[model samples]
Target: MDRSPPVIVFPPESGGGRRVTIRGEAVGTAHGLFDVLELLHSAGLPAVDTAVDDPELIEWRGGGPYDWNDGEADER
Candidate 1:
């Protein structure tokens, strides 16, 4: 699937101004990252690095949040 360009998902039963997620990972609530998002939006960019080696960006097709589930897990 095309995971690029990032996807921002809002919380359930909430309005646009709520918890946000990028690729299934929580970045911040809408009220939290408002300024950062605005800057990126104005620049025509899609996302921020979020962290120095984003854990969410690491591909995982496993069962749950456990990263070291097994040695055969597929990770990018």
Candidate 2:
């Protein structure tokens, strides 16, 4: 059997608020470490606060957190 996780497409936030999107199999819903500020920026929302996560996942090519921006560092 092929058991794989769903690809969650995080849509850009709207209204300059923190929005979290999740997509996957039968898994528990838990909030991961995400930057509300970045989410707002990506969603073209107003940049007011500087949100950050402890050891965030980098969205690099080939899956997993590999890309680093600004002062964010890569875990893998």
lDDT per residue (tens digit) for residues 4-72 in model 1? 434343332224234444546565543334433553455455446452124443222222222222322
Clashes in each model (backbone N, CA, C under 3 Å)? 0, 1
Candidate 2 per-residue C-alpha lDDT over 21-74 given as tens digits, one digit per residue, 9 for 90 to 100: 323322221122345334435555443532231122211222222223322334
Model 1: weakest 10-residue lDDT segment is: 60-69
Candidates in order have lDDT scores of 0.37, 0.30
Error of 1 at 50 (Å): 20
Using lDDT, give the best candidate's number: 1
- Model 2: lDDT equals 0.30
- The alpha-carbon lDDT assigned to residue 12 of candidate 1 equals 26
